[model samples]
Target chain A: MKLSELPFNTQAKIISVDKKIISRVAAMGVIPGTEVKIIRASPLGDPLELEIKNYNLSLRKQECKLIEVEKI
Target chain B: MSKNLALIGNPNVGKTAVFNELTGQTGHVANWPGVTVEKKTGKMDKEFDVIDLPGVYSLSPSAIDEMIARNFIVKDKPDLIVDILDATNLERNLYLAFLLKELEVPIIYVLNLMDVAKKRNIEVDVDKLAELLGAPVIPTVAIKGEGIDAVKTKIRKIFSDGKLAQKSSIPVKYSKEIEDKIQRTEELLKKDAPHFLSDKRRWAAIKLLEEDKEVIKEISASPNGIVVIENVKRFASGSEEFDLAGERYNIISEIIGQTYKRDKDMITTSDILDKIFLHKYFGIPIFFMIMWSMFEFTFRVSAPLGTLIELGLGALGDLITIAWPEDAWYTSLVLDGIIGGFGAVIGFVPLIFTMFLVLSFLEDSGYLSRAAFNMDRLMYKLGLHGRSFVSLILGFGCNIPAVMSCRAIESEEDRLTTILVNQNISCGARLPVYVLLGGFILGDGATGTIIFSLYFLGIVIAILMALFFKKVIFKGETAPFILELGDYRMPTVKYTGIHMWERGREFIKKAGLIIFTVVVLMWVLQSIGVDPDTGLLAWGTDPENSLLAGIGHLFQPLFAPLRWSWIAAVGIVFGFLAKEVVVAAFGLILAGEEEPEGLGKLVVGNLAVAGVAAAAMPALVYGYLVFVLLYTPCVAHLGAVYKETGSKKWTLVSATYGIAIGYILALIINLIGGVYF
Candidate 1:
């Protein structure tokens, strides 16, 4: 499943990220093989907040859809 | 040699608070990131001048701020760097610090918000973390001035000990494949491009493998640099960029596992608040409630004080009238030029002060990030960020500070778009034009609806222009919305107060000076003309002979389609001093007409004398309001635009674009109204 479709609070690991956005998101420690979870979605429900590397990062669904993920 | 110390951090990490403590300079600090859009410098004693650069998550130049921080770190090469970190968010905060390690500069790590970390039950072994990063760490609550002396003492110690910062080992070594690629570039640089070589060659090698454009541009200055780059491009895989950043995180996880401790399951106040503030259904309503309350607090509370300043200035003018009892040129200069020009700015003091005070509090409390996070989805559709929403709402209060607040927007394209469209938001000063004119021609019953329509029109135009600019001018991919919804802490009064005063004081100094000069210059222009009888230059107040009236006649034909006279043309031109002055200009410049008992009637009564049909006057007033709503901002607004943008191109775009659009829109309004009553 894409990271955008992951259920809230369900643990997952990033399988592979699109090369277009890997550097920026990966810079914050969201890389392949890292455990991640969707903590919350923002008010309008487009930007999802993910808990990874002991911090919360907000990314819009447009970017999140590019990341391929699998349930852990 | 005079040395410099630089402060770098992620946004909302108390970096500017640390800056203020070290330099004794008061720049604004808030929970929002990128508050220090441009670097600020101050004397840290006679020897060291401290520089504060805007926060960036990484050294890659994806945006203007990233470019700014990267250039300072690479080109200026400050002697020492102070990396401020949020202790609770250790792994992510250290990401930039890890990147800085590649610079090979001596660093003193400042771990701020330690109290918040402790409350979250996170334990940081300071000594171990410092050793892992190869730096001295001092934990601080920078807003409270805690651990500040330790940071200063360590800076002194590092500067005194000259023989340090040697390359001990590789910084977070990548896999063997990428390592070989780095070695190839490093060896090439040390041999053929010695002219461009430094201790940062290893960093440049890593950047070359990552295809970092700024570093590539630097190395390309030497001819051999192309050969080196082409050589690397042959054997190197494109995934080295991901591998390198991945390796750094791998190393960081190892460091955190050993030295950092935390309770991951503990729910905190920020989370609870976010549940309501970022609620699926209620979030936007709550956000707007807070915004409306902020608006109410700014104007409703400051209205009396604003009136007090205006009345006080009036009484002083009355006193001068009583004391001299003479109709002299000096009296007019003092009353209209000096007092009138400067007094209008002083009236803004209470309103601007309270507006920033509330905004600073919102930003410092961590609610601003939530506001942006919630608003970003809507704003992103409009080609702006969630953060631009705050600046736009603040524009309703005044556009000067609204433009200044755009600093927190990281992308240059988004920020410029926000500033360009901000003036259409219809500020408080513009309200006087709407209310005073709406009542006289249309009566008191229609005034409220007219004011509402003009404001609604301003917002619609602002949204349309934003979309227009995005599709045509900016054309960059919609900006990414990556934000850290940081923990909310109780904001300290001392910090918020200082932030308010510091930002408000900027309006007084920069915008204030511009308003004063234009007001006085307008006075001089209205006073001088070719003497009607002598046919020579002379100082007089005759409306038919003055230069201002002549300029008014010049532009009168442009508005002739709207049925406005030359006198109205003169008022619009004088409105440039500030929007609030347009009403007073009508009262001052309408000579030889029966001065009606009230201002609204005076403005309305004179339009008929200028060839506007009595039936068409009301419709023309609507066109006039539309023109005022869209036209160029006041001089004070332009002064602020120039000061913040520091680019003559953007400021000139702001000045000219609005007048063109305003003219076209107003003409459309008049033509359509010509069909009806």
Candidate 2:
């Protein structure tokens, strides 16, 4: 399933990220098999937050859709 | 021994505080030659020099900041790197540390914010971590200047003791497949690559494998080297499958397990605050309350000081008038031209300073990021990045810094669009015009709502324009929102005060001379004209027959559709210099009135002579207010646009677009208010 479809506050494991945004996202320490939890979405819900590697990183929904994830 | 050291780390790792401790207060900030990224360099105890690089997530060149960081390290080859890390965020922070370590520079690992980590029960074993990374480790709580002596002692030892053992002994080794290619690249680099990195074969190898643009371009200088790079590219290797970042993280996870410890169930204060601040339903209203209180506090609290300044300038003008009672040109020039015009703008210093203080406080406290996060969804819909929202909020204080603030934005198209629309976000300079016009013409009770509606209209128009620009001009995919919601920390009193003072001082410096020169010129124009009876150029003529009146009349027909008078048109024309002069224009040409109680009354008293009827003042001024809100920001702001964009064409676009939109919006307001009045 897509990371964008993950329920709020649920834990997930990254599968693969689309090649186009890989370099940008990879620098933030997001990569295949990294454990991530969707913390919350913004007020209007287009940009969302995730708890990854002991830090909170925010990403737009358009970006999240490019990452594949499986709920753990 | 004179040595060079570069300071680098991931964003929000207390890097600036660490730099302050290392260099004291002697740091000089400048741009990196051509780039807009600020480069901070300073001398360490007058013995060693330190260059502070921009914070980045990694060494890879995805963003302009990252590119600069990578280029600085590779090109300058500083003797040692002072790598600052957030001890509490050991895993994420170590990622960049490893990338820097690959540059083969001896590093002094400074674990900053140790006090916060101790409170959270995260203990980083300094010695063990130092042993693992093969560097001298010093634990520091930089804000208090704790543990800095040890870091400095180690730096001095490395310089005087002998040459550095630059490369890490226990480097994070790549996969076997990647290692083979690295070895092959090493041999090729030693033979064909520049002699600069030849001695540093291992680092050059990794950079080549990473396809670093600089490394490739340099290697392309040699014909044989170009073929070798092309060969490496054409013949694929299994090493390509290895995720370099993930591999580094995996090794860091190992190092973290051995060298760091924390309570498993510790939930920080930052997490708790994020819950309420990030709450969906209450979040937007809370954000608005904060903004409202900031503006209201600026208005109500700054009133006393603002009034004092007004009275002081007014008294000085009165004294000058007493000294030169004659109808000489210099007397009117000193009294009505220089004093009157400059005084009108200078009186708002208190309001501007107070606003800067509050804004600096907000930016330092880390709520600004949450504010950006909260506004992200709305901003993205408006055809702007979440970061643009921060710049627009800064625009409310002043647009010069607001336009400069767009450097944080990564995408070029998004940054440009934000810069273009920023002038519409009414700044502190424009506030004087609003209050004077709104209070006198619109009445006290409705003025509050009137001011609020004007601000709301600015945002509405900014968003629509951004959307239009996105769809019609400079179109591209949305700039991805990738922001670190860093740990919330208390803003130090010293830093916040400095930030506030510097910005407020900057505004005065930029505005002072421009306001003086333009006001003086306007006075001369308004004071001179042919005496209608004698048909000769003379001073203190009827302002209707003054030289200034000719300039105002030249543009009067352009604004005639709004039923605005030539005087109001003249105010808008002078506003192009600085918005505050709009009111000064009114005060000067108010039928030469003898110092009415205040500018508000002066504007009201001149309505009949301005060709604006008393009953029609509100509608005409409402249109005038809209024009001021959206028209070209002052000259200083346009200069900032040109500096930031580095394109004359874009600066012209930024200027012209505002006037076009201002006319259209103001006309809409006038036509609508024409029915209600």
Candidate 3:
């Protein structure tokens, strides 16, 4: 499933990232095998904040959709 | 021998605080990323030269800050890399450390925010971590000045003993397959090793395999480089970069597993705060309320202080006028040109400082990021994401830094749009003009409302222009909003005070140089002209025949639709130099006719003389304020825009757009107001 489709607080392991921003997303420590939890979505819900490796990162739902993930 | 120590870290890891603590240099440390966009250098204990680099998550350069940090580390080749890590988030930060380790620089690992980490029951075994990383690991609460001496001692030891490099651990190992490919690539690179100047061939080979653009460009320029690149590319199946990153994380996890421990159930204070601060319903309103209170605080607190400054300048002007002979050219020049023109701009120092004080507080407290996050929805409509708003908010303080801060925006189109629209935000320099005109036209009771409305109008217009430009001029995809919301911390009075003073100092410097020169030139133009009747040179005699009047007449027609007179036209022209000069030009123009009690009175009297009727005064002033609000930013901001855009064509486009928008908006406001009021 796409990372953005995960419900709030759901923990998932990243499977793959889209080619366009794979390096950028990975550089922020969101590589494959990393367990990420949906922290909070913006009030409008277009952007979602996630917790990975004890740090919070907010990314647009569009960008989030590019990351493939599986529920852990 | 003194060594250059480069401080590197992930954003918001307190790298700058560590730099400040080590070097005793105030480098605008904030809770946000990209505050230190440029590298700052200072001497540490007269032994090491400390360079504070912009924080980056990894050496792979995707953003401007990351590019700067990567370029500096590779090109500058500092002797020692002081890698500052946030102890609370070692797993994420250690990835960068691993990357830096590949650069082969002697590393001093400084784990900052130990206090915060401990609060959440995150304990790091400093000695074990040091042994694993093969570097001196010092735990510090940078804000509280803990472990600073230990860091200094380590630096001193490195300089004296030169033992750090030998003691450093081997770089993180990749998986077997990746390791085989890297060894092969490194061996291939060894044949052309002379081109690799930094002796970081392993790093270069890995980057080449990872297809790092800068490294590829470097290698591709050399002989037989394409063959090597092709070979490296063939070794990895399509996912080598991800595999490499995953391998690094695996190593980091091992190190973290051995040396780090934390309470699983301890919720951070930031998480608690975010519940209310980032509340879906209340976030934006709370942001605006805070902003409103900030402006209210600025205007209310500065009013009395502004009055005091005005009184002092008035006394100084009187003293200058009395000390010189009556009717003398020097007397007029000193009192009218120097005191009148310069004092008008300087009178708002109190307001500027107050506004900056509050802004610095917001910036340092990390609330500014949350505010940007709240505005993401609105900003998204304008082809900009949330981070663009940070630059716009900085625009309120000054457009120069705001334009410079556009470097932080990842998208080229969004950044340029931000730079172009930033000038409309009613900068602090433009505040005095608003307060002066708004107070004159709408009375004290409505001054705040008028000011707020003008600011709101500026934002609205900026949004419209951004949408138009995005669709028509520079069409592209908006970069996704990816920002780290930093933890909210109590702002220190000392830091805010220093920030306020730094910005206020820039304003004063402009007054001393740009304002002073422009005022003198204005005085010269007003004082010298051919006598229209006799055709004789009339120096400071016939005011109607002055050069300024001639220039004003030429420009007055353009602004005539808004009902602005020739003098106001001249003021607007001078305003291009700096916005405050509009008020100053008016003061200088009416200097001899009357010593108006205040700037508001002088502006009011001038409007009446300009043939603006009493009923239309408010409307005309609002229209004129709109023009000033949208017009081309001051010369300093234009220079910044040019520098930021790196294209004169875009600069001209921005300037022309601003003037056209200003004229059209002013005309619209005037025509609508004429029909109603």
Cα lDDT of model 1 by residue, B1-677, tens digit: 78988899998899878998998773333322333355577767668878888778888867667677877878888888889999989888878988888777767789999988999899999999878887788999899899998888887776677734644213656668777888888888888787674767888888888898877888888878888888888877888888888888888888899899999999988889888988999999999799768766876777698789878986997798788646688887776666654565566568767877887788778887888888888899999998788788778767877888787676778888898899999886676677568875467777867877888898898899899888789987766777888888678898899777776776665445655665666677778887878888788647577887788788888777666777788778878777766755664554224553545676776653355456666777787888888887688788778877778998898888888888777777666666133
Higher-ranked by lDDT: 1 or 3: 3
Two-chain DockQ for model 3:
0.72
Candidate 3: Cα lDDT at B287: 78
lDDT tens string, model 2, B1-677?
67788999888788888888889868877788877678889889798899999988887765778888888778877888898999888888888888877777777888999999999999788888989888888999988899988889888888778757755334568778677877787766666655636666787677767776767776777657786686667544523423677788888888898999999679999998888888889888899999999989988888899889888877887787688766788878777776676677777778888889889888888888999999988788777889999999999989988998898887888999999888888898888888877875458777777888888889888898899887799777667899999989888988788778768877777567777778878888988887999999987888789888899888888877766667877898898988878877876776257654666766655442345446666666777788889888798889889999999999999889888988887777766666224
Candidate 2 regions exceeding 4 Å error are B1-3, B162-172, B194-200, B234-242, B321-334, B524-550, B587-592, B607-611, B675-677
Instruction: Output the better candidate (1/2) by DockQ.
Output: 1
TM-score of decoy 3 = 0.95
Off by over 4 Å in 1: B26-37, B163-180, B383-420, B427-453, B471-476, B529-536, B577-622, B634-657, B664-677
Displacement of residue B172 (Cα, Å) in model 3 is 1.8
lDDT of 2 by residue, A1-72 (tens): 998999988889999988777777876878887999999998887688999988899998889999999988
**Which consecutive 10 residues in model 1 chain B have the weakest lDDT in total?**
B27-36
lDDT ranking, high to low? 3, 2, 1
RMSD of 1: 4.1
Q: What's the distance in Å from true for residue B581, model 1?
A: 4.8
**Higher-scoring candidate on DockQ, 1 or 3:** 1
